[model samples]
Target: MLGPAERAWCVVVPHQPRGARMARHRLSTELVGTIRPGLLADVVAVLAELVGNSVRHAAPLPGEVIRVAWRHRLDGDHDIVQVRVTDGGGGAVPRLRPTDLDSLDGRGLHIVAALATRWGSDRDGLGQSVWAEFRAPAARLPGPDGDDPAPNDLLATR
Candidate 1:
């Protein structure tokens, strides 16, 4: 289960060509050094796909904007990152499309699926939201010399 640090970041950006870039930059800034580097990259990539799809296919929300939200928390021994993008309802439901070599597009959700531990979409009264969740490896802290070392007792000539 998610721990107490449930506060999430939600940003509203112009639902236009640049929205995806804005979302990626903001999310990367917010999450840097907090999660694993590979996990951070995956999160940013998923955010880009979600925001890009919204801009390309969906309508803007009530004020010509879309909502992007993300949160990360330590759950037990590992970290979990959740990202969501909400847009005015219009486009067809998102799914992993089968793509071949000649396909120029339709691989966004596939990437999301492959990277995220789990993902899905939902609709509310105002709009639709697509979300993905990633489980990061257990946090690793440095030892006294700033490097992880085998426990002293285990290293004692057993």
Candidate 2:
């Protein structure tokens, strides 16, 4: 677990399908010892969807690159993991689109919505950044009674 201060990890890769895979690898490696298995899986999936969207929708301009970053911080009792993927500008704004059962695509945002606690996207001067936040399961600690402390109690400590 990180201290009270925020800690971040990031990578920049060429805008391509392979770049998303590379970003996933880097994210997994960086978070190996820090994040729990289940939460790690969710985080990786979110990264993939965001990066894949950048590759498929926001084609990079000359000299542009896709950037993926994750930051960890303690918010009260919860450990908050925030991820952002930025790509070159000029793509359509990301939104949830209804898909038919016969459709083979268009589920990326759906998956992200299901997994992330909160998510949104914004346009910047250079490009758009899609961001998501997930609250990691709280760490178990012995309470005064020698049993696990309730979640509310943990927050009070903060």
Candidate 3:
């Protein structure tokens, strides 16, 4: 497993359907080897949903683009990943509302909520941002004596 490491990245893409694709690819590329495969996949999926929502429902920022950002850090042996997608403000805020069972649409926020440990939205002067945080594998594991792993373990599972 990888050692304790931290990184962040941001990219601005045109506010179009293709923007989500680009953001997903960038997220996967930046985080590929730094995290476990399953964790990376979940992060990428969350990024996709956030970007897709911005492109489909919100307007472009001042530059007619959407900003996708992510941060990866070790929080006391817990690996955490948070992704944010920013777009021009919309009349409605992003939130989890019950969807029709037979409906073919409006489940993006639901999927994000299911996979992310926490999620919410914030508004700025020019735009709004929707973000989610996920927890990666921790360093703690049963020791020879069935005790918690040492602090020096560093959660190195890479």
Name the candidate that leads on lDDT: 1
- Residue 63: error of model 2 in Å? 1.9
lDDT of 1 by residue, 1-158 (tens): 43354437899988987998999999988877566688889999999999999988899998999999998766655677899999996668888889998999988899999999999999998699999999866445454567753322111212
Clashing pairs in 3: 1-157, 1-158, 2-158
Best by TM-score: 1
Distance from true location, Cα of 34 in model 3, Å: 0.9
- State residue 1's C-alpha deviation in candidate 1, in Å: 14
Give the range where candidate 2 is weakest over 10 consecutive residues by summed lDDT: 149-158
What is the per-residue lDDT of model 2 for residues 120-149, given as tens digits with 9 covering 90 to 100? 999777578999999976555566678976
Instruction: In angstroms, give how far residue 153 of model 2 lies from its true place.
Output: 16
Give each model a TM-score: 0.84, 0.81, 0.83
Q: How many clashing pairs does model 3 include?
A: 3
Over 1-158, each residue of candidate 3 has an lDDT whose tens digit, in order, gives 43455667789988988988999888888776566677888888888988888888888997789998898877765778899999986779888877898988889889999888999999877589999999866545466577865433533433
lDDT of each: 0.81, 0.80, 0.81
Q: Which parts of model 1 are misplaced by more than 4 Å?
A: 1-4, 141-158
Report clashes for each candidate as comma-separated counts.
0, 0, 3
Ten contiguous residues with the weakest lDDT in model 1: 149-158
The predictions' CA RMSDs to the true structure, in order, are 6.4, 4.9, 5.3
Evaluation by lDDT, superior candidate among 1 and 3: 1
